[model samples]
Target: MIRRIFPYPVLSVGFFATWLLFNQSVTPGQLILATFFGVTSPWLLVRLDAPPFRMRRPLMILRVLWTFAKDIAQSNLRVAKTIIASPHPPPSGFVRIVLEMRSPYGLAALACIVTGAPGTAWISYDPVDNVVVLHILDLMAEDDWAASIKTRYEKPLMEIFE
Candidate 1:
């Protein structure tokens, strides 16, 4: 019953906070409306049969976020350099990366991290074979790219989600 009332606590809190922020003042009408929407949305979502997520390591999630931020900054600089150096055109292509992390949340995080980076974009994911196709703005060496992704992103994601 309690779970049904608040199926997604984080989402509910976010919706409520957004509502208050948008209104600029938390009047009774706004509060009631936000509460009703937040509570009802979760109940409707629950009917769609979503599995519960278990976050294994909260600290590791923080670490992943920090690492991702650093990578994004570095990639942005690298892409900028490649773009400015017109003599040597960037070798951009798609590469399939075999994934080891099995958790849905981990995969979702990985997708966001890859797509968020300026030089790299996630194209598609194969759930059956656990592989992801990514397009890089500059492709130097496939082996090097795969190794770096595994070491830099996949390793931390494995620790956090798996």
Candidate 2:
């Protein structure tokens, strides 16, 4: 059945195409190896028993991507300035964010987004409390940082994934 053989059709085709591109030739050996990988990856994924994610408001994903890109660019500049100036000691501290998203996939995406930002690093997450701890290189105001994250990242993710 299609469901069992290729639970993730997009992933399978991408892997197969990447393998062919990497090999740079369509030899029998390459074909066999690519087929093996494509088949095995789907099989392994099927065993994981992940729920089918219903992505509501798919355009929100684009919004999230754009926001992340802008934040990364701005954060890179801010971090660079902090490193070069060395005028004052860096204001680094940890802050705990209470997350409303309970889905594992959503939480993982949130963690990636927070950590990908230059000034912040995800420390630990407590599932029971739905809280995430993050260390920020420049902690000017906890409320401002929390509000920015909730508004910029979490709200969009909640729309898309939750």
Q: What is the C-alpha lDDT of each candidate?
A: 0.85, 0.88
lDDT of 2 by residue, 1-162 (tens): 886678788888878878999989899999999888887777777778887787888999899999999999999999999999879868899998887887777778988999999989999999989888999999999888888898998888888888
For candidate 1, give the lDDT of residue 107.
88
Q: List the residue pairs that clash in candidate 2.
A: none
Candidate 2 similarity to native, TM-score: 0.85
Worst 10 residues of 2 by lDDT: 38-47
The candidate that achieves the highest TM-score relative to the unseen native structure: 2
- Model 2's lDDT to the true fold? 0.88
Query: What is the alpha-carbon lDDT of model 1 when measured against the actual structure?
Result: 0.85
What TM-score would every model get versus the actual structure? 0.82, 0.85
Report clashes for each candidate as comma-separated counts: 0, 0
Deviation of model 1 at 8, angstroms:
2.6
Candidate 1 lDDT, 8-29, residue by residue in tens: 8988888888878888988899
